[model samples]
Target: MHIVICSSIDFTPQIAQVAQGLTRLGHTVDIPLTSQQIIAGELTLEDYFAEKTNAGESARRKIEHDVIRSYFEKIKMADGILVLNFDKKGIANYIGGNTFLEMGFAHVLNKRIILYRPVPEMLYTDELLAFNPEVIDEDLALIR
Candidate 1:
């Protein structure tokens, strides 16, 4: 299966590990760029901070628009989506924006929706359950 692994850019390591696992399972994976990544090739973190400190609101908005446009491009290429809610920070939070946007796009495109949060404790939370009550054990089977 072709899968698009989606999660926040700030959580790159977790997303990379999940992507590797999915690839090993014979699935093609496309990972989305993180927010910081738009300028990563051109600017260091310090440079971004410096720029943000000096740039006008209009410039920041333009940067955000570009990042969002790049995100849409990735969505167009995905077949199925995998939401990585497995957190490296030890804080049990829902999977981030990339995954949610992917989910919305997959829904519109009639693609498979596979929400995989590896932390079992977090999985049973009201937050996730509420976000997607239709998800059942059959979906969970895909992770293995």
Candidate 2:
């Protein structure tokens, strides 16, 4: 199965561990961003002044919207989604964050949902955690 590993880029080690487990079980995994990108400059917010100096605020907003839309299109292509654990900052406050939206989209589509965190603490709430969760099982049959 082609798995969409949805999680904050900061948790690369955790994602890699889960991905490795999935790979051993014959699944392909794809994560959105790298740990370096998250640490250096994850596009959490925009600077209107910077855009105003060049392409103007309107163009900047459009670009942001387009980028997010493109990402969702990519998520739609995945066979399943693996939601990781929230960091200390908490994923809840990051509502505009792409991870949350991708997870939500996957849920609505009724695709295979895999939760591969150390603990069951949720960033969204109880409603989001109602879906079936995947545990590490080497003998689990492949969906593909």
Candidate 3:
């Protein structure tokens, strides 16, 4: 199966590990562009986010638009998405705003939605559960 991983860019290392595991399983994996760039040292996570955080509204809009579109295209090309949900901000299996949006896209695209952990406890947890993502509980083999 071909899988596109969806997660916070902060989890680049863990995403790489998951991607490798999926690759070993004979599955083609595509990670978040930022994750790939960060792992490759082509991009610095802090600076990228810092710029976005401090940018003017228009600039931030443009940045977000470009990024969201790029990833949307990637998700459309893949067979499914592997959500690399990890603990963040004291929330176990955290799915932040962006990861949630990506999953929403995958769900709309009729792609398989696999979660590395159970649905998280967040404001949008109900909406996330509505997507019906398959929880694999960190078992890469269970992704498919």
Candidate 2 Cα lDDT to native:
0.58
Model 1: which residue pairs collide? 9-34
Sort every candidate by TM-score, greatest first. 3, 1, 2
* TM-score-better candidate, 2 vs 3: 3
Of candidates 3 and 2, the better by lDDT: 3
| lDDT of candidate 3 over 1-144, digit per residue (tens) | 989999987788899998899999999988876777778998787766776578584356448658788889989999999998999889999998888899999999999999999998899999999999999988887765
Off by over 4 Å in 2: 34-67, 90-97, 118-123, 130-144
- Give the count of colliding residue pairs in each prediction: 1, 0, 0
lDDT of each: 0.58, 0.58, 0.86
Q: What TM-scores do the predictions have?
A: 0.58, 0.57, 0.88
Output the better candidate (1/3) by lDDT: 3
**Which one is best on lDDT?**
3
- List runs of model 3 lying over 4 Å from the truth: 49-65
Candidate 3 lDDT for residue 11: 88
Best candidate (score: TM-score)? 3
lDDT, candidate 2, 33-106, per-residue tens: 43323334644223333543575664565475574565566567878877775444553322224566776778
